[model samples]
Target: MSLVVSSINLKIYFMKTFLAITALVSFQLAAGQKTIELKDFNSLSVGSDTKITMVKSSQNKLVINSSDDDDLSIVNEGGFLKLNGGEDLEITLYYKDGLESISADADAEVWGKDEIKAKELSITASADAKIELVLNVKKLNTTISSDAMVTLTGKAENHNAVVSSDADFKGEDLLTENTNILLSSDGTAAISVKGIVDANVSNDALLKVYGNPKKVNEITSTDGHIKIVR
Candidate 1:
């Protein structure tokens, strides 16, 4: 009887110890931040409900700050980085090189930390996506649709934007030599131009232009409105 009781007590103690260790490991993984090394990539595509902060860095790296690091998919495919993130996954990607293009979709929010310097940059966003970026580029191109919103600042030599499907772009702070913008389907934009503006607004869309421009050619239809102010 004494031997059997001692054996049972030992078993219980081991079980309790095992449970405690497992709980501790789970808590550590939940609370700890993970760092991942990355290769240099030119373009990035983000999907799902992830929030990312992109900033310039001396080396390429990714830091997973929230949730499990393994749950987020980060892959470099042919000089392009594709990130498929979950609703709770938050990460910061630091890159050494200038990014050429970015595509954001499906509730992803991307914020740029510092000035993005590139020869040319292209951005496309849709479906509740949001982007805030500052660029110093020769040429910039953007396409926004489906309730997405983009805010742009900094300087570009030339800019072309196509906005539709209730999207919004606030870009009055971007100093540009030339701007060509088209808006349809209740889209709206505010821009600043220094040289020339060719604007076409239709289908209840609205455009507001700022800064002193050398020339302006604007066309509006279907209750569309265009306003240019100093």
Candidate 2:
């Protein structure tokens, strides 16, 4: 009786182990890649950047090709195209549709092509997320709430930026008049720009402007530093 009982216990253990393995395989198969598309949207909002890029296409279609299809989502809400991606992957983008505006939020890393053209652009970054965009636009606005980073290149009519925590901003060729550029840093922010700059800075932040200031404000930095180079 003892031998029989031992044999039965051993068999039960093997059966349970086999069942667990089978369940794991089924789950892996179910989590395969998925594909999705949208026909019409005026703007874009992405939660995070998983190695995404925009390319000019011949057709008027917005395509998102993901490395892991199951980890990407695209939605159209209120005439806006919203995108979200998984933690450590990338999604490629192809678009010719006339998108008017674009925004990145919720701790996302967004990278654009070298010559992305738009009417308006905005970025609200926090939680260590970063955005590197090279765009030709009319207006650009950026807000950094936490320890995030943003870098912008290309030409623009107006550039407005605010950094409140340990955030940073780097602007290249961000051409605008003295009256149209506003850059403010409330904390230990690091800001760099290569255009005519007029700014008000505070705290232990650093602002570097590589152009002239025609109408200067009382640019105050309580415990900060502001540097300008022609």
Candidate 3:
């Protein structure tokens, strides 16, 4: 009888300790976050060496973690949220409605934490920038140029990619229904297509195809290579 009573007391003690730790963690997380007041924005323009996590929220909001005290220049002009003037920054961007476009140049890193649902989304990364995102979009347009790289991991009904000047589109996990690609000037694309692929490769460009598409309409010469992934 005494042994069973001791066991019951121990279980109750552990449960109380667990609850206290959980509450402390929740409080710390809330303390480290603060909201930014920027509204009525439909697009994003990032131009800093920062990392951002985008969240889909019921209210259109922007947040940045207060642990890092990097100076940031944020503005909302003409339906676009532009972020700049920081070296080491961490931010959280929230939007209720669909985002139209995102452009990153020279130095920026941004990603979506949730599956971005949109009608049409355009991404432009150039001049040694890097962007990674997931999309549940109808029409997705991408232009990777001038040694930039864009990595995608999601689904798009129609995806059009134009890679040029040693740029790369790393989309092996981004399954597309129909993919149209224009690879030029030693650019590279690693994509997954389920329905059909239309490719125009030239001048030492390379297209790596995955997902075993139903049809591949290729217009290329010996100067370019279209390799199938098994």
Candidate 4:
């Protein structure tokens, strides 16, 4: 009976020590992976010039982290999160709490080195924002109000664009079911669509469509060109 009691005590002691070490390691990891919460927000919106990347993870929280986290400001405004930063910032956005959509209205540059998976995305690129997105989403909608340069690639179900200035929009390998464009003024679009295209372009704005377009309508441009490929 004494030997049995000694064995049980030894086992309990080892279990306690193991738990202590495990807790220590967990604390260290949590400290290393410092993240800022996007609290009280269901969607993400950026109003300043910033660079953003989406991280694909199973965690359900919208958290952002950067190497230099001091100059960044993330605010929640009426159930939406807005991002603002200074200098060249590499921002990683993780949608851990079921973030559904993204909207950006600033003159920011978006690099395609990271991939974003979402249900919907809308970008209003004014003031000549150099925008590029490599995404896997259901719908992609964009509006260009200035001479912004935009590029979009990846797999999506639907794509819609509206250009109102002397901007250039390009898409490569953007396999989608439906593509729609409404261009005004000196806007130009060169895109590759896998399905159908419907465009109403006017006033020296050009539209180019490549892929099997089942239906096309009103693709007109005065002093501009409309090119289509099967």
Candidate 5:
């Protein structure tokens, strides 16, 4: 009887230990599967049949499709975009027939090492869109082609900042600090610099500066003229 009782107690202890280990492993897996969501900083993952519209209060990173039916707009705020931060953010913005609008409040920065093909990209702000900060990076090689106006209220810097349509760029200070600014278009684009203007332009565009001793480093154009008024 003593031997049988001792064997039964050992089996019970083994079973209890096995159950505890299993529970711990299950809990760990569950914790690893959890996701994080914030109020001001949000991330939206779109499905094949849905469109995403975002209005950010602070800074955000967005991933969208260049060939989808969704439309994006940045009205009063600004944000940033990492196309391939970890994985590819493929939210396609279809032509006028797909997603209606994806707009932000302030400046919007887009970082994509590939090509960015769009019908139209519009940014309207009380300030300027800081595109030069992300342009000097060799990891980001992007091409922007739009039919609508590409407007900037601040300054821009990059290896290539091309606008194929009419551009309205107004800024108080244009800081190309250590980078270059390139503006080009088949149509006529006008740029007005309130303070210092440091950029290089193609011949087809025009630039007008209004300030005290505007520092325009280099102005190159195949057919455009730069008029400076102090």
Candidate 6:
């Protein structure tokens, strides 16, 4: 019985040591992390192998330029910008009063705003890429290029949005006073709204509309299938 008790205590001690090491490593990693800030919005250029974060407080315009290589970008307007994971590069932007735009020659992803008081915003992406916008504001408008995917989520007061992709448009638990969604794809595309969706579509693309249609004021599609779910 004494031998068995000793073995159990030894195992418990080993587990505790492992947990402590893990905790220490985690704290060190977090502490070593750094934040990059872009205050002056002149002409900002980023390589296809770089990642960047930007925040704008004053009325300044920033331009993002990238090559036709693997890249990614995340932007938080007038707030702390955070970005993680990318192959070639990632760039972020924050436009206070001037125009802030992101242009990618390769596959890239961009975000409008982050965890804070929701506001009205707009986002446009280049072709042959994917873009995601998470808004906690009153309204949001988005325009996606060909061979791209645009996703919008959060609550809004009034929203007028357009999405043109060879892929699809997906939404989850989106609430808005007025919403509009438009898709133009060569393949299959769909709109899943939790609150409302009002828009139109074209091409031989497949369009699936779900969620509360009554909450969704209007929707239109051409050469595509439209489905409404309560």
Best by TM-score: 1
Candidate 2 displacement at residue 134 in angstroms: 1.6
lDDT for position 199 in model 6: 60
What is the number of residue pairs that collide in model 6? 7
Tens-digit lDDT track for model 2 on 47-157? Answer: 754445665664433433323656666787777777777456545455664666656666667676657677776666776677777777777777775677777766766
Q: In angstroms, how far off is 18's CA in candidate 2?
A: 40
Residue 135 miss distance in model 5 (angstroms): 16
Question: Whole-model Cα lDDT per candidate?
Answer: 0.89, 0.62, 0.86, 0.71, 0.36, 0.52
By summed lDDT, the worst window of 10 consecutive residues in model 6 runs over 40-49
Q: Which stretches of candidate 3 lie over 4 Å from their true place?
A: 1-33, 67-70
Candidate 3, 66: how far from true, in Å? Answer: 3.5
Among all windows of 10 consecutive residues in model 2, the one with the lowest summed lDDT is 58-67
Which model, 2 or 6, shows the larger lDDT? 2
Model 1, position 196, has a per-residue lDDT of 96
For candidate 3, the lDDT comes to: 0.86
Per-residue lDDT over 8-86 for candidate 6, one digit per residue giving the tens place of the 0 to 100 score: 9999999999999999988876564433444533222222324444444554333333343233444444533323334
RMSD (CA, angstroms), candidate 2:
10.0
User: What digit string (tens of lDDT, one per residue) describes model 3 on residues 79-130?
Assistant: 8888876566568888777689988877677788588889999999888778
- Sort the predicted structures by lDDT, highest score first: 1, 3, 4, 2, 6, 5
The model with the greater TM-score, 3 or 4, is: 3
User: Residue 203 error for model 2, in Å?
Assistant: 1.7
TM-score of 5: 0.33
Instruction: Compose the digit string of candidate 1's lDDT tens values, residues 1-230.
Output: 99999999999999999999999998887677777888779998888887889879999888887545565778886788888765676688888867899988898889995999999999999998999998899999999999999998999999999999999998999899999999999999999999999999999999999988899999999999998786
Backbone clashes, candidate 2: 1
Between prediction 2 and prediction 4, the one with superior lDDT is: 4
